[model samples]
Target: MLIKSEQQLLNFIKYSPIIIITLIAILINSLIYIQNEQNFEKDLEIYKKNYIESNKRLTKFQVEKAYKDIQRERENLEHRLENRLKTRVQEVYLTVENLHKKYSHLEEKELLNIIKESIRTIRFNDGRGYFYIAKKNGFSILHPITPEYENNDVSKLKDSFGNYLYKEIIDHFKTEEEYFGELKAVKPNMGNKKFEKVTYIKLYKPLDIIIGTGEYKEDFNNEIKNHIIREHIQNVRYGKNGYIFIFDYDGYQLAHVKKEYIGKQRIDLVDSNGFMITKEIIKQAKKEPGFISYIGSIMPETGKPAYKTTYIRGVDDWGWAIGSGFYNLDMLKYLEAKKKELRAMNNESLKKTLIISLILSAILIALAFYISNILKNFFTRYHERIENEIQENRKKDMVLYQQSKMASMGEMLGNIAHQWRQPLSSVSTIASGTKIQKELGMLDDKEFDKGMETIVKTTKHLSQTIDDFREFFNPNRVKKEVDTQVIYNKAIQLISSRLTSKEIELKSDIDSTVFVTYENELLQGLMNILNNAIDAFENKEIKNRIIKFDIKFQKECKMPNCDIKECSQGKEGYITITIQDNAGGIAKEHIDKIFEAYFTTKYKSQGTGIGLYMTYEIINKHLKGFINVENSEMKHDTQSYKGAKFTIILPINIEEG
Candidate 1:
């Protein structure tokens, strides 16, 4: 029987090797498949990173290039507008000079006829078809072809063109030089229609006079407006949503893609870009030329990102800005679409590459599986040990999370205790006083009413204390605008009893106008610092223990040295509150760690070492402000006392900090 069993075992081993090898091959194949999946994921991440970076660069380059192109176009338009004005002014000057020479030998009536005939020839030859001449003393003469302006004084006129011409004539008289330029105007006779008019002046030395001629701007070469309109269209065509427009220095629409907008008073348009065209551009137009970009809403639009990039250049002759811009979004969409397409193609290619990798991985896995079966039984016991270790590690993680929660709870509770001590004492004292007065039989009707009122007030205070604690613990409140004075008053009220108990004198220099944008619970944070100051003063034996709280409204101040991220630029105002105490100051080495959680100078039982840490969190993270500490000698009367002062500088407009 023994011989027969041995022969059977040998036969079993020979035939079952194929089956065992097949099972091991399957296990190895699964392991290789998992590894290949991980590799594909890593590759996809790399591809995405490369694709995003490339597209970001491309978009930035395109935006910069477009900005430059618009700048060049604006410069060209401004040059053309200036040259046109100069040429028109010269033509009028020469024509008027000839008329003066011819009429020098004639009498008043024949001279007038010659003057009238000369005006006709000048108006026809010069781009301005209708010409009007006004003397410095307010006499007006019109060309024979257009008799409307004859014998009219233009000095009292206040329209854009009239005002501009008046100023140019005065300047020319003062400088004794020929003055020529374009002025924006709205003529009353023309139904108050606005127009850009070219004005020219030449001195008549014999008459001791200045003769000023003005021609309706539209009657001149139309290229002045056309150039402006073309620039606007180019900028608008490249932009995303809105069209571009140009305005003269006086805030009159010179040219716009929309026909109705041309020659309109831009100041009346709610969303006009005229406000952004600086006075410097106008002032410098005659001396130097340049372009500037500004944030302004497109005409006839409301909402954010409704801004257009306006490029302005100085027109020397007209003293106007040849400005143009398109809506920002309109210019950005094309690049955005290109980026999206590139991202999509990258993702698709990545997916195909992953699929190919998976197929290759499957083949490698199949080969590995066949080789692994030979040793599978040797590794089963080790796999069980690893699984047990992983389970133990998970349990440890759960324990750590629980401990962290308990630590946070303990710290929060300590802060609550510090905050509530004063209110609770006030309630207790008021209750005891009420009872004593009633029991002593010394309370009259009025006195009894007063005592009862005190009790009610104390009860309300206790309720408020509870509410304050509840709010501090609740972390879901949204931030809103808050009055800084109210916050300071509340902190003073909360710490009043504590200050009394410790015999610490409280002083405040709070500003009433200081307002802040923050969550309500931020008041609790300030109270925490006041409470700590009270504790520090009480713990030490310094005489005349005092806590000085000052709230200053600063137009601009640096952020405090706390770990808070500044919420806005330092341009806006800030509420700076300084809480100072007259106790022994903290050591220099410990000041740096004062805001770190679980690090405190107080005894283990006295403090959880989280009050200042939580205060830092509230001031920095929640309030979007900063907190800092300084140790210096404080003077009370003639005596010197050393204590720590905590200064919190919070932005009044958090958005600008």
Candidate 2:
């Protein structure tokens, strides 16, 4: 019995873990299914909302496109019509003036008769236009359509629309030479109709007659409205059943695809949801042409409550609001189909997931133990690899820095050659003269000594050129106080010969001498900048090549304008060095990139493209100064020239020990 109790306790301990794990797995699966169901519901809601909003935006876009197209057509028509009318009126004016000139020599009655007869026969614009004569006092002398009104004072004649036709014409002609008006007028073969006419009046001073002719606008338009309605508006279709419909701003339905709905008042019409559809559409249209939405109009195929999105636009010329609509039933149908598909997929996936989860649950326990041990080794190796990569990167940076320094040294060598050429030529010339003097029997002791002294001085200058550049490339980090003026002059001396060769004048001003560390690097940077200016003058036809340096002292601050912010807080001032050159300035596109490594505007053979880049890095990093470059009009003395200005803001001496 004791052995049996001990065995039973061992069995219970071994099986208890499996039983508890199975229960937890069941509970976790149930929670996962519930959470997945909730997430699917949330996602479906979001998708439906997003789809509806996107459809609304699409409908608005369609409406605005149509509005722009129609407005453009209207403007084009107005422009053409105005030009045509002016041209037609000018033709009639020239004809009447010629006739008046021809008949002016006859007797008064004869002249009047001849002029009237000549004007009566003239017709233009396909016989729809004719000449008429009127007196300055508003009496009609001739009327082509109405002969009886010619002898009568027809100035007070009112059209069918209560517009005083002749009186308005005479009043307009009193202040202007021409007239364009619309009125009820009699055509030759047709009865009175509203006509827009352009009339021109010529004052015949000799005969005291005002001769004018006008063309009917209806004839000039030539079926433009019908063409626009048929070709432009009616045929323009957008989605499956989308179409344009027109209504006046006051809500009179003028044109629609469904013929029976035309001529109906829609301002008070409501959708199935009781929203005032036409009122909202017209209100939106009357503002700038844009889109408005209202739910109405059922889908014919569905025969259900359908959502419709319409875009509305106003036509100011005809006082009409036009729009098109897209039904949401298509999207709804797609959504419903997708929902059914997703539901089926979810059910299938749930069955598979439950079976798979049971299988995976067993494997997960084994992997948890196995992967932890693997992760420990992986982390150890990963840290070692990262350290190695950092070291490699540091070596690469040093290599790049050395390469850049070599490139700068090569550029300085070119400047050195330019500096030594003149002195070497002078030494050679002096030696040649000394030889010629000895050969010619004119050699004197004092002359020979003077020549020898000059040769020595020139050789010393050549040696000093080498020394200046040799110290520039030294990698020693030595800090010493430097006067700003002295530093500027030293840099200038290195490049002065090259400047002279290019005929570029150097101008400099140093107001206060300030001290800074890394004086040689500063001088090197300044020399590199001056060399660039010198190189820029190559092949340039600037009348006066000039480079300028201006130095001043400015108080430095911890923050911007710290003097006003905190009364007692301050730091040492800065030596501000400005270098400018008049080589027509750097091109604007390349100004920002000039300091970047391997970026140069010069030929590859002429430049290695690291001189200015090293200069920038040296000033900003080694010397702890700020440098900025821009292209602007630099004024030197009395002349203003477009040039590049480089400003170097350098800190004063910081070493205190």
Candidate 3:
């Protein structure tokens, strides 16, 4: 009912599946792509963070390893310094031992002078090394670098650090034949500033004399420091452009790739943004050894200051800030490559998703068409079955119509005989009388003319009656204009004889309205109703047996389910015929079924049951009108009459069959 037609239904079935699936596919693919894009952004950010964090860790570890290498190399330098001092002190002690042995018979002063002179000229450690001899009572017997303090009772004398330097040295000699210790002394070549000196002393037991020589690191910066910086720290390299650089807190570049940078004050170094990179590195190094960002900083690739992430470390003992970094450009390169890979992967994923959606949509479309085809075939078969059934019913209706026509013909023939009986008798009687008169020679011309004229008139009346009956049963259907009252009177005329034989009174109420319709078919349908009512009166006892035909030009609706636009518009609507009988009302149960074919209450031979069915078929299917029956009460002169009322509504002017 919603689809209205087979083609519309089929079309809907055909296109709906693909349409629905296409929308769903679009929705699903869009969601997937959106979600993937969101995830891509989120994951890329995380990847950047993780990558930067890993590089920071790498830089930190590299700097820490370089720091450890520097520490190891400095320890080696210290060990070598200690070895040189010990070896030189041993040679000077052997010189003293030899001098004491060779001058054993000489005076102690002279022996001491000989030992001092021998050790004095035997300077090692770059001429900053020297020996001294003291008496057993802490008296300075001879001195080389500080000869002004010699030959004095220096028992209360102290070094720059307020220590009794000579007494402590003699006490050490008294206990052990040799000793090694630190004493506050001054380097003659470096002015009179006290410096921590490392000394080795030996006892000359033959003269009860103490001899000592010492070395300090006053010249370390010009020699050993440079060697360590050049060999160890500067030579340490990691990745490309990864070099260890050391600068003191005082801003001197201690170890560097550029020879000019080494041992140069570079604290005021700046980058593109005028940011003091070395100053910031130094600041971070002092607080805690960690990472720092250097925007507009230097890079190896560009050789210009750009962005970099650096790790800074402090070597507090060396007053140095150590820093190493990889450039931001390098990290960007790695991240950019990763981004390109992710983009390719995301595009491929999206492509696959779209392709999969397309494939699924295609499959759904195919499935939809497959199902539509199946339904189409089923509908076609169903349509064929229904068509076959409708055709069979139509054929059966035709058969019933023919049978009803035959029955009506029999009734019409009987009515013709009834009406013609008296006329035939009168004609026969007139002819017999005329014949007798002529035979007897007593019949006059007037009498003969009268008899002959009466016969002619009677026979003409009979012929006219037959013609009306013949027209009533005529099967040829054609549309024509006719008077409604005349048509109804003709229907009553055909069946009036049957009503008379049953002692039924016919009441006529006809409206002289005009109609355009099939004349004979309408007449036949009306005749069937009158005949059916006549038959219903059989064996019925009714005080005032009456059959009424109330026909009129109905302007209002009669049939409840009327489709005529004129009826709704309150125009000249329809011709309504209400045929009722007071013989008796039809049984309630059989009212609805009475119009069906072969439905009858009478004996099979007496009631063929097709009269009303034909009427229904003509009114509903053929004439495009409607008919219904109901048991109702009709009053005439205050007298109640209850019977079956058959109402028929026909369009006042029908344009279609």
Top of the candidates by TM-score: 3
lDDT scores for all predictions?
Answer: 0.61, 0.73, 0.80
Candidate 3: tens digits of C-alpha lDDT, residues 15-68: 977788989998998899899889889888988899788878888997898778
Clashing pairs in 2: none
Task: Put the candidates in TM-score order, highest first.
Answer: 3, 2, 1
Q: TM-score for candidate 2, please give it.
A: 0.42
Worst 10 residues of 1 by lDDT: 233-242
TM-score of 3: 0.51
lDDT of model number 3: 0.80
| CA RMSD of all predictions | 19.1, 27.3, 33.2
Evaluated at residue 425, the lDDT of candidate 3 is 96
Question: Where does model 3 exceed 4 Å of error?
Answer: 1-14, 70-76, 94-116, 133-142, 149-154, 159-163, 202-211, 217-228, 295-297, 371-657
What is candidate 1's lDDT per residue for 346-431, written digit by digit as tens?
Answer: 56766666566557656655655554543354345466786688799889988977777776676556555666666668767766
Question: What's the CA error at residue 187 for candidate 1, in Å?
Answer: 35
